[model samples]
Target: MPQHSPLDLAEGDPFGPHNLPYGVFTTSDEPQRRRVGVRYGAYVLDVHALAEAAGSAHAAVLSAGTLNPLLAAGRAIWSAVRAELVDALTDPARRVTVEPLLVPLADVALHLPFDVADYVDFYASEHHASNVGQIFRPNGDALTPNWKHLPIGYHGRAGTVVVSGTPVVRPAGQRKAPADAAPTFGPSQRLDIEAELGFVVGTPSTLGEPVPLDAFADHVFGVTLLNDWSARDIQAWEYVPLGPFLGKSFATSVSAWVTPLDALAHARTAPPRRDVPLLPYLDDSAAAEPGGFDIRLEVAINGHVVSRPPFSAMYWTAAQQLAHMTVNGASLRTGDLFASGTISGPRPEERGCLLELTWSGRDPVELPTGKRTFLEDGDEVTITAWAPGPDGVRVGLGEVTGKITGR
Candidate 1:
């Protein structure tokens, strides 16, 4: 709807022309965390300050006790808040409105924008699921029988979900070597990153009351890049009947900003092929309403460039996943979190994670300087996405980068 394109965007810039994601941040100098601002270009704007200054325009939403309360109020308030910020931040003529709060990205210490009450990560990527299953199942069935029918997921440890820039410890677990014959307890040798997008819940639903597929988007506050780091070696031994535990629970990295769908609504595209007809409850009209977006996602290693893949590769749509999630009437809180399973492309090189790209290290990925079996200490991983819309005021998911460090 807004455009400042060609001139404003630098091709792959995530905060350029179209995207405007919001996050909670305070200057590093601040002692406490307060829900403070939105990310635009390379800076954080002070929404809270804007409220104190604008008085009326910001009073409806920004003046809230906190951002979480505004999020719980749902899209109406979110759209209102974002619109106010967009008008104030991008318009040079609106100097008075823009003067209150502005901080360079470097000056801020970002925190989880909202309190995450619970987390559920979905394995809806067909290719990701098929490939991962083959590693363990080998024969009986490639996908779990119900996988095709519903969105498969695992309850994640919400307490460990941290904002981006948080250091993920190199996990310690049991690794079995053929020579040893028995498992050896040690630090994970296969610590890897999974490039994923997570959706945040904006409102709460009543328990035992199913959320209709049509109403799913109304509850989604926004989206962010999520790195569900994996310790494959440890996972192989621990995930027998129950799914991931410690191996997957240590830490998760997410972009500081949560891009609201309203701003990126113009970026929506259609969902990929329907492998199987969805059940009525799982069937959603929104999934068909340009359910996909042309957001181009990319990864970089230690500042070196990696391939950029599109979000369109996902076969199952996020709307379908959200709709299916409520079929059983599981109440989602105002700040619940959900990750789209690792997004991988059909071609081997386009895969999202090192685990898939390197075929579990059997084939190492060739970087600019050389090959990589998995992430090495000192290596940095950055994930970013953006799309163009009317007027070129492109909407983007700012770079979500993290550097690997020794244990």
Candidate 2:
């Protein structure tokens, strides 16, 4: 009997030809040499090899070890290369040449797809922000005054961003409780996870120029699953006047695969109803495209599904976030990363973090392993998501997972 071809993926496979998410990988045979590849079914197609073999004009950009070159190559080149890849993989005549370049996913080690230029995380989910407000300030309003008007975000440490599967060391920092007389320093007792989606910037902008809402696709290349690990105890103590610092700086994990923005056309939807009128820069009322995505995210602890956060419920969309991020003339750069903060929904089961789901330790989540209010040492957290694709298919965003280690 003949072996099945990798190209002949089963119908409705998320990572089929329709979803060619890019990544960087290295094989044991050449562990030192990193190559750019695309996920197809359970195999990693060597895109550089394919481009070179086909004598394509965009071969140089794909040949690079990292995706920076290709990311910097603007939207036109990106579309052209993607078209070439689809034609090559789907054309039966080209299968003989393409088959040899395909490598088993298990045989390769995936790495950070690009060198991160900068990282920004946005508190765009109304459900998440409101829950946090109610948890911390039960007597006050659930939503902040500025919450409905603008997309709130903070710059993050870019160096600490890691690819999926990286082990996270439990962060140690100062913490204080109202009952305590003074602050104490030790490993965080309230370690938590924030399930979100991250947008990757491709084309850069001038230093003092602001990227507009319509240019979102021109600047952003793709999306990925992001796990912005948090230490709630430290954050609670430090986040006043100033935003998250040490609590959020320790580490941020992102998926190895980047699902290009073009693949998510079918997933685009209008953002949730807005009660407040937005300023001209942040307003999307006249935008040509629907900014919200219909992606559904799942959070898992030790392999047990916990929450399902809907990205469509987010109040601020990525386009709005980008517009607001650069409203002050902040420039964009290739490989710049911006996350959608914690994605949550109106339902209790849709909360994105343990801080909200467990209500700041007032409640504990029951798991087969044990009860958990906060992540324990050796606990593993994984976030996965998928969006609707053309023809009823699903575009998988892969996953970002990390296991916590004791300090």
Candidate 3:
């Protein structure tokens, strides 16, 4: 029997030719040199090697140690590179040339694909915001007054962002309970995970020019699974007058693979209905393309499936977030990352975070190991997601996982 080609992906494999998510990896033999690669089934394609072998024009950018160079190459170059990759992988004549560069995924070490220029986290889910509001202010309205108008977000520390599987050190900060006389400082008692999707910017905008809603695709390159680790105890104490600080800055984990926007054409869907009218810049009701994605996210702890958050149910779309983010003339950067905050649906099983699922420790979630209100020292949290692809295939977004370790 003829041997199976390394590119011969199994039927319905999430990381098939249709979903060639980009990442950076290094083999053990050359651990110091990081090469840009595309995930193909169970292997990582050495894009730089393939480009050099094929004498492709994109060889220079693909030779970079990180994705930043490719990201700065703009949308046209991105499309050309992706098309070349697909053709090279699918065409049988090139199999001999390509097969040599295919490295088994397990034999390589994945690193942060891009050096994050800036980080912003948005609260775009009505269900998640409402649940959080109800938990903290039971007597007040679930949705805030401005919730329906704009995407609420906060700038985060970019230096702390790590690749998936990196150990998350439990953050230590000051905390004050409702009945406490004074604040205390120590390791956070209520560590939590926020399942989110991060949008990566490829092309940048002018420093003083606001990017309109229609320009989202022109700038955004791809999406990644992001786990926004939160220290609820520290956040609660410090987020009164201002927003999240040390509670959130300690660590944020993202997937190694970044699924490009071009592969998600079939996943676009209309966002949830807006209760209030949006301004011209933020409006997308009459846009040519749907802004929201139909990605389905699953959150698991210690091998136990817990919640499934639907990205389609998010009130605000990524396009809207980009528009709002730049409305005040904030310039975009090649490696800038903006995240879709905890994606939750209306159902109880759709809650995205432990704070919502367990209701601020009032309700403990029962797991095979034991009950968990917040993440424990050794607890490992994993978030994986998939979106619809052409011909009914599933496009997989790489999973972001981190294990909690006491400081």
In the range 1-407, model 3's lDDT, one tens digit per residue, is 99888989889999988899999999999999999999999999999999999899989989999999999999999999999999999999999999999999999999999999999999999999999999988999998899988999999999999999999999999999999999999999999999999999999999989999999999999999999999999999999788999999999999999999999999999998887998888889899989989999999999899999999999999999999999999999999999999989999899999999999999999999999999999999999999999999999997999999988
In order, candidate lDDTs are 0.75, 0.95, 0.95
Native-structure RMSD, model 2? 0.7
TM-score of each candidate structure, all chains considered together: 0.89, 0.99, 0.99
Range of the 10 consecutive residues with the lowest summed lDDT in candidate 2: 280-289
Off by over 4 Å in 1: 1-18, 28-35, 57-66, 90-93, 135-141, 177-180, 285-288, 368-370
Clashing pairs in 2: none
Sorted by lDDT, highest first, which candidate order results?
Answer: 3, 2, 1
lDDT measured at residue 229 in model 1 versus the true structure, 0 to 100 = 85
Model 2 CA deviation exceeding 4 Å by range = none
Model 3 stretches astray by more than 4 angstroms: none
For lDDT, candidate 1 versus 3, the one ahead is 3
TM-score of 2: 0.99
